[model samples]
Target: MHYLFWCKDNNTSTPQDMCWVSLRMREQHFPGHVLCWVSMRMRDHLFPSPWQRHDALRAEVGAQAGAADTARETSTALYPLIVRQGMDKYKVLEEWRAGSFGATCIVKEAVGDGRRFAVKKVECIDEHEANLALKEAMVLLNLQHPNICAYKEFFITWDNTISSLFLSLVMDVSDQGDLGGIVRLKRQLVKKMDETVIQMLLGQAIDVLVYIHKQKVLHRNLKPSNILLKDEDSFLLSDFVVETLAADEMKLKIRMDDECKLWMAPEALQFSYSEKSDVWSLGCVLLDMMTCSITNDAEVAALLQEIRLDPVCLENVLKTLVGKVGYSADLCQVLLQMLQIHPVQRATAIELMDVPYVKECLILVGSPLSGVKKTLPPGVSDELYEGGIEKALEFMQIYTDFEDAQISALRHLSWYIADQDGWLCIEEIIRLVVQAMKLHSDSLDIQLEGIWILRDLVSQALAHGLNEECFISNELITTLVRGMRSFLPNTGLLSQICSLMMMLSANEVAAELLGKAGVLQDTLKIMESSLENRELCLSCCGLLWSMAMTESHTRREWLVYAVPVIFNLVLKHLHDGQLVESACCSLWILCLKGCVVEEQTESISWALLESLHAHPQRPVLVKNACLALASLLRTSELAAFRVLVPVSGKNGIALIKEIYHLHSDDPEIVENMCLLFSEMAHYGDTRPEMLSQNMGPFMREIKVKFASTEEIVTLAESTLSKLET
Candidate 1:
């Protein structure tokens, strides 16, 4: 029998690649025959056009026809089948799997729609096998459950050598592959599967079994290979084999292959089986999954042998194993009941569903909040972290009430989501936490947790350049600012609040909202009350720096109140690098807008220069210090002179030269130094000071060295021209 798979080449004008597989059975001298599968790849001539193509071929030809005639005749004969089965609407992408019995190929909608399906082909040697394959397809067609693999439709085709059954199974392409594959892969990662996941898998497996039993059907092949996982939390049962059950005879004899022996029940080996027989196989599957978690396969093999030797002692062994692996005791008991040696003693699927372990597992697996409890694998890559946060957020959206446990869970989950950088800036999560804070205003813990969550989210967002539309909402900003006011006296809470405010102010729209919502005043109050707390003061300084970067009106409002406070903080905390750095950053932004007067600029510049000299190695302080000086120098002539003059026997020119020499490698520092020299050259008095200090030679050298850099070259040229004039 020849099976062909065709895919349209959308990139070309014609279909260039058509794959064919010939499954020829070996000749036998006896009445009964054995099938030996051989797959050979063959490609045919390109079809004329996509519209006029054969979907599939099921011919009973005694002689080979010409390629042109075969194509013409097949297109005409298969056109009705293509339309009836909607085959033209889907094109074969590639073969997923192929074996003696059949093949599975991936097919996608030809209309460029995103829908995909796995199309399985079953080749039957005779009429009996065809009937059995059709019955299996019919059984799958009727079964629909969350844990059961979905079946779309089935069709029949025939050739002189064989009849084939084409079944479309609507299933997600499992990238992680089957349960057995996942177990083996996890073994390599050396990461143990968490018990919560095990319990959840067990519950889901039993749930599907229960459903199938209710419909009076048996999943004869119950093993890890047959169980497919859509994701970490979703497992589906697949590969159903249809068979009859005798009313009086509880057992039906069947061939037991080596693969089947691994999961087949003992009673089934003795040719006596029932629904409880499936329960025994499920026990074996559970054991397989549990043992797979062991990093050493040898240990798993030995453990399995021990359980097989003393079936009744399986409970004790499982208990020890699960306990060592952190599985719950309830699950141990459920496994014990399911693995009972006698068929009558084995727990039925319905009874298994009622088990406490199963119930708890169902709740945890089904609950959206359960994702928060999962222990992510080690080295949790950025992709895994983001996926976890997305899953948690999806789960949180389903529940509204702010119960104590739920609130606490959300608080910790927020920490986890915020623990990593590059969060996708989920606005809904931010709004939900903000609403939680508003609703539970009385709970200080909830408020603090919510505030920290917002702080981390905003920090990551700003760091990763996430959009600011959702964060700048009136309700969120207003709620946060109000929380800041209410939590004023608490130093830790106030620090986080200030930090969050700083990040929010990074966005112009958010800054406008914060300024309008009285965040400026509330922050001032926090600074006033926490004057002695350097952390709080540092955080407030950072917040003010962000606020000063907003529109001119907002910058002016902040400068009016921030200038004096910042100057005092700088003078008071000259020895503290962090406080000095933050204060300098704030002053830089304030002065950039010409918001500082001559006296304030002079005092702030002198203090900053002292801090810069004290902490020459601090890159952040140096960068901010240079920026502040440049801004002050560019403000006005008087402001420039006030800041340029010597203080405490040290000249401002000398200090600027020292900073320039010390951190020449920093681009921002270099750019700002050039700008300061340019600003100084624009003034007549400082122009002589520049010449006296030999600034002309330095400016010429800078101009040549940074010729490729526009900002530096432009500023250097302006300084040299002014100096020469």
Candidate 2:
């Protein structure tokens, strides 16, 4: 079947990339359209059409009960399945595993990028089963941890040959294989599993379980075969079948094979299951892994089965386990807690995380923060502080798919990096954050955490007077802009991203990179949408000001669009002094960039003066306001006349006088105020407005008060000369 698909995909198939959109497309469909395109003999086998659906079951019973188990006995090589179809047609490379109701295949994309994926096709015998299958697959979709296999896409189709409905799930492939395969190999070679390897597996798996159970979902099938090896140091729990077993009856499909019975909790055997059942199953998998060096598969299975009849036997078996290591005794104790026969007596995955040996594994895995609540003792903190960074990096590298872990590790890494000495690792942190963002592109939380880590890195560099080489890089600037583009409307995220961009813009090279990435336009878009969010506008204004310093060409198009919006925001958030100050800084930069359209200058001048009036006591706001007012008048002659009218009962001159009186000791304010008057004096229509407010005396006082300051003295002399003339 695969050979036939290869020939057709290369020679006969048209519509190169059809996406499976039907599962989500009740109103519109490409999901069903995808199934149709991937089917080799399109006329023979049944597949969903663009609008075709079996909303209700046509027949209740399967054409044959117990047929799925029999179907798995035959070689799937003779009947390869497409198993997946989406933005690209997936070509099944090999039949990885066949199950009672379905099969998982190793497949490569036939179009675009050629990425590999594992596609599982579950045969849903009827509409009800198909619906339940879809609901189950959706559960997997929500269970995206670094330790759980990542689900990509899924859709339901039909197989007319078997008269069966099939739901296909496409997930990320862990090429190294599953725990069962490794255990079997180690047993064949009589090699013991490394202690660190055991810790990696159990720690990561329990972490995954804690997250899953908190979400109120179950792994359903927790065995060595389901625990896939992502790499040497990572394991992913796969195949969530969503079997709903009640106290009396099991609802979903299950094969009562002997292997399943060997690992099942006694309560699970009685058709009752809970999260504790998963604990028992995981313990069995771990036990098998531990004892595989000395025991055969048959012997382990028999022992596991016998434990159900006599729970006391587990302690004896643990005592004789061959691969005992430093934490073996404690781990065996924890395993005893997990393998308890009664659900009420069993310790949950969460409780296991707190055990000494388990916490040691979590720390060794560089995930010290997941579900572990007590404050670390000073000894542990010191140990972690000294060696934790690399372990955290390892944790991130090993579990790249795990967003929660990524966030926890990153946040903790940030706490460790509070001092200047830690700033040197900014580049590595940036690289990891970028990679994590790309892997979890759809995760806003990861994206938020990534941006925050980058921001914290930049902030420490700035505060500590570190060189640009410490944090600013082309890649950092690009990621910042990319985040802005990706989450434009997420004000919480955008506010942080915008703030980071503002920090990056301080460096001329970093600012240029942002300019090239079209950062200014994104800032304008978010500011317009988030005018009501004071912090967002404040950060956006700061970003625009920084960009304007080195990006006049980039600012040319966006400045016009931003002017009215900034003017509006200034009026809306005048009570927020910092926001008002930022708006003033951004407006002046726009004026210097030659961005004044005469239609906007009048409104811009009024907003600046209003900011001064609203926060005249804030020295920084007064200083920025004076400079912004001067730049507006110097650039647009019309602005001088437009701002002559009183605003909030104070015209431009009156506001400047009040600001001068309030900030008399501030030389920056005195200098910029002189510049503001000089610009006004050059304009005939507004010059008397200054003189009539006793501007001549004000200029002399500024000149005398700031005589030693060259820029201030020059500005004061110039303003006095202009008013006298």
Candidate 3:
């Protein structure tokens, strides 16, 4: 059979040199527009349709035939032109086409049972051209994936170092011809294919990447046109023009095309790529799959700008995709997790295997392993249908049949309990939280919810006078730590963990575990970097204050690190009343214990006394400062005592005057001030003389206003008696 398969290179112009090859076509009909590819190697031309074996060969066969005579002469020089039938199947095929990547015959020979097999002759113009073909052939032969075109055999005609490859033949045309042609023929069908079938094809492409990674290879040239889909199951991960050692290759083959760059990962554009980096490109594939509506730079740029501005809202994008595609929420969740910004955070093929929806494929193959059991506390029950803790636990289950319904119900319940300020539900809420923690042990959201529930429980326990030690355990600490480290870096959950640990400081065993867990360092490090993160800083201050207030013997050593940091933080962010109050409270606790540090006592004491003088907005600050001063005078006869005494007196007088002029209605302030001065007189060794001087005028003012401020006046009289003594 003779055939003229005309094809233009579109990029190259050698129309006069187009090959018209003759070959046996006894089995298959030669349909117009149906590409019949013929390769010299049986394996290259006869494997499968996805191989595009016949099509690729046909395209090459129609390329430059003017240089074909040169290729034929070279092939004849390398080996004798033998035309044996079955005995020379390999030899005759090589003789026909030599010194080329592989050529296409318009009428390709089908490897049918006992037919007249004929090889179409073809060639390349030069050795350089031939080497390009060899390189492509070697790469094709090396490649192995479900989506890739399979390479079968290579022919070296014993003529003149001429070579050709035989590959598995694909469809005559395409699913609807080339992508450009398909884009024109069936716009809606192609869009639907892009939405469904193409996703599977891209998934196959990613799977190919996973395989390449396993083999330590990289398919650096990845683009949509290279991704060919024939059907749901039949797809091709083709076009391996650039191959390199994934680890060793630093340089990449640059393409002039603009569309390919759109799907490339930022790291890939920079040429610093790894297997995980390919996962970023895969994420682009996923995003393309999710939103088939956008294809151009303007749309992509707009979407990316939105993503960049508020990356946390990526879940919303996934939710939108769910609205469009009617995909499972769990599947969307898996894809979103895979697209996480950090390469380390993105899912590998094996890690993707863990996603519940991804595991559905494995489930079809065999039954899934049961969800692993996590330890739950004794009071917590697992019976979801029963009453008590069991019934309450249903509110916290994240992915049950009633998860969406429970979210609304749980939100309402949480609000109702908090608004009413009911403390009775504390135990019940805690048990539900524990059960939730067990149910969604692997979920970040559930663990975060558990922490939040624990916070509410702590506040409720304190309000209801429940024992603080009741919640402390190895189990609680382990849960908190696991959740903290489970997500990389900080998830803004450390503050809650520190707050929970602070509540546990009243317990000896839990406090020790917290301290030994390097909880102190964690809090301090956060404080160091988190000076601007108000909530985190405040929580750190609170934790430090609790640690100091525990009254343990080891408090002094921790104070060496905690005290200075707390002081600097107070000075920097004094506008925050909670921070100020917490700083003063911490100072009060440290001073109440009277830590004896000979080297740093004077400076620490002066700083404390000055903080009292500089910030007098809250009475709690003054009261604690006075207590710290009194404790210092009582415990240490060092320079701190002498330095802190007169400073405390001046601060006290300043505070009293502020109260007298501004907050005179606050009788508690005047009463606490009088008591503070009285305590200083009896307990302070260095402040008696200064107190004696201030006591006269303070009493005189109180005496004149005795009727209006009788409680303060009475306290002042008592303080006067102490001063006289």
Candidate 4:
């Protein structure tokens, strides 16, 4: 049935403009032009050609659209031979599943029933090639079991070359949709399923596995999607394309699909498989069912270890076999034994069936006996076996995917909004993360995540927002300080913690709390470290700044003990521009209280002033140095003006003159400088002898810049006038 197509125009606004296709069918030689308009919204506003519009279905389905219905209508071309052999008599319905293997439906009369039955066909090949439906029909006919799907028939009779098949359909017994959907629904309806119901459903699955294995068959791909429950109790297994013959059976020449081989047993994955191999696959399926969602391999391994060690908490069992279907710890033990990597030691299906609890399940969860046909509900498709993790990850990795471990860790600590129950969840999550870390402490992912979680814990406690009581006062400080040293090279984590401390330690009460908590010394060591993370170092400086400037005199004394380290850092980095800026800010924070005469202020100023003259390129260093000296001179009440000359080394007055000149517009800097001058004026007034030596050059520079500087600058200039007035 060949057809020729021509062009048409489009009206809708989309990337592919509307393309009208003219068609001529070979059967009747009927000629007609169908308007198969592509979207008017091209890449931005241009239209794609007719062929491109037809090929974009896969991309368009997942994308957001406004004119999808119209686009679907415009793209349906008869020239593509819409009606093939077995499907010619049927009227095409809308698409059923737009999954990796596309499946569409049509209404066709049943051969035996002579009534209309919905026919679904999956196609991944050209119209001339055989479709997945044909292969599926051939594969399903060979299976024979009570819990397994029964093949009704196959259809592909056509005089012409077009060939398609139809077969019996299985009901979509997905709990909600997929496993994620089931988990979400369970969260909403957790109280609905009694312990008995859970046991029944799980037991039914076990029975289905047993029945499947007894037929000398290995359902290599056993998963949640393969196990469907009708009315939440009757479980049936379906969809077997990669089934393998038992190991002891005579070899059969069967074609295998390498792509679907991942779900096979580890031994089978490397070699041939036996019916016991199916048991290992069943273990993975059970893990998915219990977790209610798929997990990464690492998490799966972790959960398996926990279950092996303490199966009672992680794996529950049924005490009584009420119906015939039931659970017991012995059943789990048997299943675990079958999943052993050494196939020789693994329990055979016959051996597993003889277990007492297995016998109980067979009688309790009796298999369904009816062969009635049931129409599957909408929204479910047979594409459930997309791929095992390796394939999924391989597919996703061809592009790029991203996640942040830190954010994941912090969010793990989030609390519930109303009852503050989220704190308990956070507590459990932290313990899990910490345990995982203890097992793999060298793991960068775990360390990064742990640091962020600790930071959030501290922040949340200070905010008094989340009701989670995961952290005691001392525990919070201990966790944070330990994270700082352990998570090396992650300056972002360090800075984040430092910023959190700056906010939490701002109040005197919090600082006192932190000091007794033993974080104060660790924080001082971090501040004095020779590391080069300026932002993180500055954050440490900010915390100390908060502490020293805090109102508590006792806290101020603790800060004073660390002053020598601070003073040394200022001298060492006085020449390096970036470090100088940090050192200056630290010095400003430290000098909140005026230096006392008996304090080390005199020696500190001498050292800082010498560095300022030597590192002239560091303007910020000189600026802060002048400010610190001004603060100290003011502390002396102008009595220490005599030290200015020796400390400046002839350039000190010039630096001070420049500091006053450039920052004169800033009130704070100008006011501090004026205080220095006013104090010096008092010294000159008390003993006019000191003024004669150094006042000439300093007085001239002050006089020249007085009017241009500030009124306070002039007042300080006139205060020098008071000394000689």
- Point to the candidate with the largest TM-score: 2
Query: Tens digits of per-residue lDDT for model 3 on 190-258?
Result: 352344444344345545665557656555555544455556345565444322222112222321234
lDDT of 4 by residue, 467-508 (tens): 333443423443454455566466777677677666656543
- For 33-143, candidate 1 gives per-residue lDDT tens digits of 212111111112332311111111112011112322543543421111111232556678885675322467778777876577766654444433444445454555545
Error of 1 at 696 (Å): 2.1
TM per candidate:
0.44, 0.47, 0.39, 0.35
Which regions of candidate 4 are displaced past 4 Å?
1-447, 450-478, 485-496, 507-512, 515-518, 529-536, 551-554, 592-599, 611-627, 635-643, 646-649, 684-718
Judged by lDDT relative to the true structure, which candidate is superior, 1 or 3? 1
Candidate 3: where are CA atoms >4 Å away? 1-392, 395-432, 435-443, 461-473, 484-491, 503-521, 553-556, 636-725
The CA lDDT at 275 in model 2 is 90
CA lDDT of each candidate? Answer: 0.62, 0.68, 0.50, 0.46
Q: What is the C-alpha RMSD of each candidate to the true structure, in Å?
A: 26.5, 19.2, 30.8, 28.6
For candidate 1, the TM-score is: 0.44
Candidate number with the higher TM-score (1 or 4): 1
Q: Pick out the ten consecutive residues of candidate 4 with the lowest summed lDDT.
A: 33-42
Candidate 4 global TM-score: 0.35
